[model samples]
Target: MPFLIVNTTVTFVALLSFRLLVKRMYALVSNSKQESYNVLIVGVNDDSIALAEALSTSKNQNFNLAGFISFRKDHQRIKILGKPIIKYGSKFYDRIAPMKITGIIIAGAQLSITQKNELVDKALANNLKIFSVPEITQWTDKEDVTSKIKEIQIEDLLERDAIHLDDSEISNYLKNRIVLITGGAGSIGSEIVRQVSSYQPECILILDQAESPLYDLELELKEKFPDVHYEVILGDVRCRERILNVFKNHDISVVFHAAAYKHVPMIEKNPKEAVAVNIMGTVNLADLSTQFNIDRFVMVSTDKAVNPTNVMGASKRAAEMYVQALQQNDNVSTKFITTRFGNVLGSNGSVIPYFKKQIENGGPVTVTHQDIIRYFMTIPEACQLVLQAGTMGNGGEIFVFDMGKPVRIMDLAERMIKLSGFQPYQDIDIKIIGLRPGEKLYEELLSDNSTTLPTHHKKIMIAKDKPLDYNIVCIHMEDISNAADSENDSFIVSKIKQLVPEFISKNSVFELLDKKINL
Candidate 1:
């Protein structure tokens, strides 16, 4: 009995020692991680509070939430997480310069451009990595917390506020109108449908070749807007008779034509397919809209059409020319308009999803060219601008959204990597693959020949360009369409260049076709 009691006591003592050692180690780790980062929050508003909370909760051992700072005098006395807010002036930086501040997050709301620039400049001068929270409301709970905290991008530095549209005007045109979206199931087309539904359109006819996505969108719209009438038609834009039949049956008053083969690499390999859809499909819709006496036909175009370098761009340019030519004809009742913009951030084929997939797969993210740059807008933003353009269209006019400045693809990759909570070039390797077929080093929003005209909305501008002759354009289009039917790729591409002399080919395997077909 004595021996058993002694053994039990020994075991108890060992367990206690183990627990104490763990506790000490844990406390040491926690203390080591508590190293305060000299963080400077720009605005002491809700965004600042949320950012403070995020910083406090972050596991980064180096981060220290120093204090808050804002240009507004009212925010000076405001306390974020019990830290006093400091004014971002000369003395403020001087006072904090002594302390090692790893980074500065500008959470200012409704800040003037000059004020934002001053803060950014000061942060940079202090050798601090700068970040800006555009508005507190932009945040969502589901957002990746780390990724949401991003470096101050050029968009943030521009200090331009988001354009506010005249909702009444949009509602006037869209409400109770039978709307037809050709690529209704696609990223842009679906978004158009969504926004139009918000206006309580009389009926929405969603036409797309893709069955699964079309079905999904149908169900979603049906569930989300039970009061709105929705129709999902499984038909390709390439089918003229089918598209016309739908227009005739539904009496679609407003047509949002977004269907096209837009993937550059895929289109480069299948130039014929690109021509059939982007060009012929567009022509079919424009003609049907006019035939059906549609009120407006808004064709979704791209920056690629500016000076097309690939089959996809060339096809889109041809489509634009077709719509423009139709608009020139006095007989056509439909007011045709084109909305040209660059890549969307979270679209089906956008790089954001690609990078996300790669990151989730624990793989090396692939970037085409380190120096390549392109304009980007959120999917919803692009669609909203499209809807706004549709309302502002007088006819034969091309509206381009102010996509701000172009973003370097490499820098975007780096930011995304950092946002993913991984040290770029350390945790995730970014592989620079050469530019793909029809891809550009940088995308251009407006050509030298194009001039901008202001609209009611600040973000949207009208591109002034000479209209093409409808008769001549139609003749060339007919020839191209005939060649497409013959499956004679060379004849079709050649005729396209003859119509619009700007078509150019890049990264294509068809060198013979490329040489023969010069725009």
Candidate 2:
């Protein structure tokens, strides 16, 4: 009887305290001469409704609910909480002054940078502060985001539209399966591990040679997902014996191959390492996946593999060919898939983080060329699409991601500087360094002989590339392996050129090899 009374008293006291708090907040709003912000919420939907309620009932905050701005085309004159919700149009500026709106809150709406910038600029002209409700990108679709509000961010402008995923399909594809992630300590690989862990996979085996990053991942996975089972093995993809042993011991249902050297200039200087890792390492994994009878093998490829001017691109192209040829063999049961995309933002050694560090250190940010442009995707966004594409693939498919429009490096630098509250060329100077070896002005998603077929996901497409004979491709693969064993730069470049005839060198010593071949 005493325990029941105590529980009942506690519940009653909590309700009583909330009622008193609301009463006090109402009195403060009524009497205080301080300017209260009549905020306009953006995009009226399920998420916005919750935000409106929170704002209405907030205490110790000088906020008054005005109305919502409909960024969607299907705008309706709906009344939310006795406030008028209006559509944003040419007359929006007129309505804003009448409504006495002091601020704008974008509630989980996906607007392009152009559209958002226009709105923010117009609101700023009218003296309105902009805030946004952040969304949860990974783990779950839970949007418990109405509790807090934050000022706008740089990612809010640069990141692409909010992607809608089929969660049920993703769960079915990953649940209870032993997923093996090669290079699980890297940006893309580590994100795959996190996303995969959320789906309750049977076991997550992370294979990476890097000790520090792998150990850090182990700590994060254990702390964030204590229930999820995972094991980390310090192993390199170049070692066939180590990878073979992993496949032999674990019943790995799926594989995400992300291990490879990727820096173009470094790989250009040392093409032998690129051959050994990007080419030979991929060969080891592809051959072992076939031998182990793994269900799905997803290889992370690059947009550089399209036209292939550099040895890095050429090496990755050779690996792509080896797997596609292996997939063409009638006897192989493993479904081989390759996802090709351009630079991932905020990835290790990517220009954005490098620029951020340089900006913090006080002046001169370096751009290779003023005209240089490349596609950008966030690390999490790329991994989400990878999981989605992995579920959608059957066999022998190179999935091309729709990476929106290419962004100029110069523009990116200026915007980043401005976003950091500094004037470009005044507070910070961006130096135009000459293009390095193996660097290109722009990146292409498709080669001349390939076309894309649309998939269920609008952001992903299947490339119907030129056909290759399995026997001939395998013969060149062996020859490249032998040339790599010889450790001769000319020998490696010669064999790679034979395998990928489109491999023309640019701004490098290897261009001489191309000239000799042309002569």
Candidate 3:
């Protein structure tokens, strides 16, 4: 009886110790979180409530809802978890400037760009961070909550008012159409196929030289859009016979030409290939479209094509000129249109994917230059604007999408680092590497001679740039093609400049061309 009592007493003491340890651990964790953040809510609405609730539930996020603030007089003054709603204007911000407010969350209906700017400016001036949820109806709410909320980016601040598309018109042009996309396995091409498939295209012919990616995309599309007819063809666009065969075999009605060697470094090393594929390849497809009487040919061009500085850009500009030239051809039964835009957010070789891979590897994310900036759009938005441009085209027109403001690469890298749940400099280090060959510090949307005309879709605009004379352009193209065929890189490069005098070489051995040409 004595031994039994002793054993029971020992067991009871151990249990008590375990309970005390667990209680202490819980207190430590709670105190740490309480020390981390104090968040202020502004413009209470559904989004604000959702954000508040999310913060309340997340143990990892150390946010304390300080209270609410409003500019309007009629909004409800309800307490969220006993937090009071206070009316604050410019003076209130000054009063709370010294408090431990980590950030302000703005949520409500859409506000004018001017009003939004004013709010953001005030927050920055007071040394406080600001975040906003998209207006009620426009909110996608797609991002994972684990992703840290970011300050309002320059893109959000400088972009114009959102433009709504006429859905019926877009649907009418895409529905039941047999669409052919060159480079269909690539970034822009794949997105075009995806979006078009959503609109119930009768058949989508995906063509690319890369066999494996083409096959993979084919399988994915087959599964996703099982009801839509899909075909994958592996062929080079530079081959006239192959392009003609595909068009004839498929009876392709709508064409999206997105195939080209786009990497600046690669193109500079082999200028002949750029000319062969970008210039001659485009001509082959344009001429074939005329022979086959394709309904629409939408050519994807880049912002680099505006006063180009590299061989790749020059070649694309030449392609654009060729498409414009073909529009004047009486033999072509196709309506040729070109869409010009800038870098996509997560393209195959884009910086976003590169940064993501770097982050996953656990260390430093590299930026080319601190001051370098470029226009950006999401892949879906870029592809959607392309479709919108195609529907609004009048044969020879060049459509440019409004890509909002240019974002500095350094800033983007920092934000991406933060979004990945790492604090810049503390968790992940950023290395500033020098710019690559033929890379621009900033990209421009318009040329000296180009001007914009508003479109039915506010995001899409028409470029009033001069179109080259078809006869002259054709002669220059023939010379370029012969030079490429003969493996003469110098002659081909020279002819490219002659065709488009705006071609300027940066960080290239071909800089001589820029000095020689007076345009």
* Top lDDT hit: 2
Q: How much does each candidate deviate from the true structure in C-alpha RMSD?
A: 7.2, 7.2, 6.5
- For each of the candidates, give the backbone clash count: 5, 0, 0
Please, what are the lDDT tens digits per residue for candidate 3 over residues 1-519? 999999999999999999999998998888676535567877666777776776677655545678777667565367776676666675777656556676677665445677777776666655566676554455445754424455555445544556566767878877888899999999999999998888888888889999989988988987888888988889999899998889778877789999988888889889999988888889999989888888999999999899998889999999999889888877777899999999987788888888888988876999878899999887887898888888886798899999987788887877666645567788899998887777889888888899999987878889988788899899999888888876767677889988988887877788876776754
- Give candidate 1's TM-score: 0.76
Order of all candidates by lDDT, from best down to worst? 2, 3, 1
Candidate 3 positional error at 9, Å: 33
Itemize residue pairs with steric clashes in candidate 1: 36-64, 37-63, 37-64, 39-66, 501-519
Number of the predicted model whose TM-score against the real structure is largest: 2
- By TM-score, rank the candidates, best first: 2, 1, 3
Which ranges of candidate 3 are over 4 A from the true structure?
1-43, 50-77, 81-160, 219-224, 355-370, 414-432, 486-488, 515-519
Q: What is the lDDT of residue 431 in candidate 3?
A: 94
| Two-way lDDT contest, 1 vs 2, winner | 2
lDDT of 2: 0.85
Every candidate's lDDT: 0.80, 0.85, 0.81
Query: Model 2: which ten-residue window has the lowest total lDDT?
Result: 136-145
Q: Estimate each model's TM-score.
A: 0.76, 0.79, 0.76
